[model samples]
Target: MFASITGADKELLSCITRLPSFFWEGNWAEEIHLTICPIPSLQDGNDLTVTRDNTGCRIEYRLPVHLFRGLGLLKEHAEEKNFFINQKMYIPEIGIMTDVSRNSVPSPEFLQSLLDRMALMGLNCLILYMEDVYEIEGEPRFGYMRGGYTREQLRSIDDYAAGYGIRIVASIQVLGHMEKVLRFPEYAGLRDSSSCLLAGSEETEQFICKMLSSIGSCLRSRQIIVGMDETHGLGEGRYRVLNGRRPPIEIYLEHLNRVHALAGRYGLNIAFYSDMLFKYGSEKHTYLDPHMQLDEKTKELIPSDAQLIYWDYYSREASLLNDMLACHRSIGPTVYAGPLLSVSSFCVQYEATWKTAGPALMAVKRQKIPMVYGCLWHDDGAECSDWLGLPGMQYYAEHAYTEGVVDPGSLDSRFLACTGLDAGWFRDAALLDEIPCINPENRWPPNPCKYILWQDPLEGLYDADIRGLSLDLHYRRTAQLLRRDLEEAGENGAFLRVPLALAEVLEIKSALSGALSWHYREHDMTALQQDAAALSELYVRVKKLRRLHREQWMSSCSPFGWSRLDLRYGGLLARLETASDRLQDYLEGRLSELPELAVPRYTLDRCGDLLGNGIWKVYDKSVSLSDG
Candidate 1:
């Protein structure tokens, strides 16, 4: 089919010649459409139908109801296309698909804010993972939703996103992660608590059908994301009460089939994670049965009509994505490739943020799957984060939409200049001849979390500058310690209302002042230092501030009329704020008086000049390396 098209038509055909040679024949290139036709029947006489009516265009296929039963073959079909295109020229449409899950319940305001940011970045789709986020109190016992938002609120978000030309796909965690439902007693029978198809009970099957039917009613999108990601721990803990004899996958497949069947009934296209089907799959870690390989038995069970969404977040290797794409292609023509952008719970350095997945994003773009989604893995639900990342997110979206390179220097400076002092300190690190900061403030970035940390020392150095960088290390260390203590104190009341917390706070402050004093002493040689007394005075004030906090420490808010947790947290934050202010004053004073040191544009030198000067050669490597 591909061979029939010559010149311009062949140009489109040439982009995918590297695909699997399994389907190649004398007339291979003549077939323009690489659509897969299984050896078996198409079921119910369904046809690959097409039409180009005046009101735009449409291609419709009357697929078999049992199309979802052959997930293995479907996967193979998807992979072959990828191999065919590896050696060719292709337009990469790297898309990110994610729905705001209820785990981090986002309101319309938040959703609109998120969508606005996404649109600015040139994203193509946003999936509303609304199932778990909103659960009614009782009745529908099998599944549960957690947030307090109304249906109107969610639809508003959907409409707003749609208006921006971003497709809003709906996602529902069908088979597992139903702990919310199991937590309540009424829905007990619906659970495969002991394994074997709810073991000893036939009612579970019918109940699941009813549950899916209900879920299907609310989701109007033509596409639905079936979150079959993590189901191993299913029926293991207290669930041993039901699914004991039935292995996790056995029950999962049953639940999957039912969902797919229901999807057909509701006139929706289905998609699910491919992790659970095969043993050596892209996300094999989430699978429980090592033997649940994509053998014939499992393959025959999956419906061909169902599309698999393969998610790969680990960027250390590309083999996983290659394997997943190959596997999905072997089965069918449609597949969804998604890469995670950021997970807020982890304190990964800003440099290694979502932009870290650039390689994977590039790979997905080249593949041009039917659907693409980016993930904001915000487990903690941080409503607002550092805006320095805004530019990076937008840049990645832009590149995904239009493949091109953007100047990092311009974006970096713009982001840093707009950010506050809290962001400026790290922004300066990029200029210090250590870590090369590409987007200091994260403005106009291709990927919001684009950054790299190298192991080798950066070149270009001077003796006087190296000495000052040494003192910066001491200041940075003290600041980090102070920040950690303050954070710990804020999280747990028991930690903050103790004498030890107060002691540690004061101790760190004193150490900071002593180090600042020594740094100022160096100015005598070159007249580079400002008044060191300001730093010492600031530290003294911080020490006194900690003393006041300790004196007023209390377990509950009885005196303040707020909750104990809130009251204690407020007090801890207040103390930390005061300390942070004083430290900032000292650093600002030093930076204003000191000439900005030239550093690597994209590396991190935590040890400052201390290591460059060979001082860290005798000190602990862990401490110094971490600083660097």
Candidate 2:
């Protein structure tokens, strides 16, 4: 539809021209005039005032994001000639941390799209969580064969983020979670323990210096999130051999000081995940432990400048979150990092995300925390897209804009205000993992889709846990719903197709083990042959899912880490064909029995600790226990 837009500068006009593709639906019968007055503000994020007058629609906004929000409001309320919208974003600093360190490094465009959406939502910042996912000069192996961004690439992304008044924060590993880079023979000396660098080592210090230099030069942001969160065996490895078992607290605090010195040299404010401090203090070494306490000495030693982020994505209770927030505050200036619940799964954990985010955000508001971020981590090889986390981010905004209880009605309307589509669209897409779950919320963050899809049809690692669940029907219906949504969703909602494809694959994949084991145990030859025939179709579906996954990955990411998922898809494809052939052989009487199914199945969940580190291991090993 033709519309005359005024009061928009070149950049505003550019974003407005792109708006139709992003959020526009049915064309207007007549031309619509939109006048945007985007003003600069000293505020952390933008606030907007949208009004409809007899002449046309006008938006008075402090930043590009607020203009976008104003545009969305104006467009949504096109019918209302007389209206006024004075929207307030409560949290001083609202941002999203995307885990690009995983297999996918999202394209600048992908990030820009997110920036556009965040702009509409009045969200202010973007954190690039790169554990060696950005190139460091003099260190080629750092993020080697991973989708690491070049300096120019990062600058482009940061520039686009700036247009929307979004401040981008750099999240790089200063001490731990450098296994990807550390695994290279060149960096072996820097390694102390699993995924951690040698504490107090001059060599490690020099390497970290390079990291600080790289981010400082590459991105415009002065804020850096130094990752030293889960250095579980910090002093137990090479550090012990060198330092002779100094107290972990002393070692950790010293490392923080060293990192602080490096960060200051680069003119950057530093932050680290506070889980380690709490873990070290708690007897059980658990994060979010209410009893977790840091001694005064340790607290005093912690750098006054270091912004400690209390990261939690698991807790569901307000009391627990409040207690934990209070505990962290006692230590130092704290930032709360909650989640979209995308960690360690093929799909978004909607139920768990909502349950945790709702209480966690409420607690942050209650505590009047200034800075909060919704972290979208790509665990288990970046199986899901970062695009899927939009709903959860909007949920954070909901909590931010509300002074009293977040209105239930405003949930959909406010979410729709950010993006034209209903919030239910993203929530529905996340149901790919919610089927096999027994509880109302998928609390343990069960990724039945990942484990079940990759688990052997006969071996069935989690078969005991899902023995009686009708996952086939659940996935089938879920697939149907997604397919419907995919058809209806225009270009703006094209991401729905990925989850739809995933659900379609899961419909058949989730049921294969149940069918295989049951048929083999019952000695049903005819049923086994039918299963063999189905594998042929499943194989085709698997190939399509992989292709779709690859296309989605490539469109938004650098091509480096794709080979990792490529190998996985290759393995999955090969196994599907092998599974069919093996079933055919068994049905033709070439094999005596299915030995894989014969192995006694054990329940994983009943073990009580299955949700611990095992959760990470299970997602990795469910495909195969060992490399062939």
Write model 1 residue lDDT over 1-628, tens digit each, in one string. 3422222234223422422232242342342332322223223443222222222212222221111111112222322322211011122222344334423344456455545445433354666564445433245443333443445655565666554445566666666655555567665665654222242244654554454554455444677777776566655644475335556666566667777776777677778877666543324444322233466776677787788766665443456555556666665554544434334321123344343455555555556664555554533222112222344444345344333343333344323222111223333221222223223332222111111110111111122222233333433443454445445434321222222232333233323322333343444422212323333443454455444433332221112212322433344345345434543554566433322213222212223422222221111221123342
The lDDT of model 1 is: 0.40
TM-score of each: 0.51, 0.92
For model 2, state the Cα shift of residue 294 in Å: 2.7
lDDT of 2 by residue, 273-347 (tens): 988888888999788798887777778899987888988878888889999889888888889999787877777
Which candidate's TM-score is highest? 2
> Quick one: how many clashes does candidate 1 have?
94
Q: Pick the candidate with the highest lDDT.
A: 2
Error of 2 at 344 (Å): 2.4
RMSD of 2: 3.2
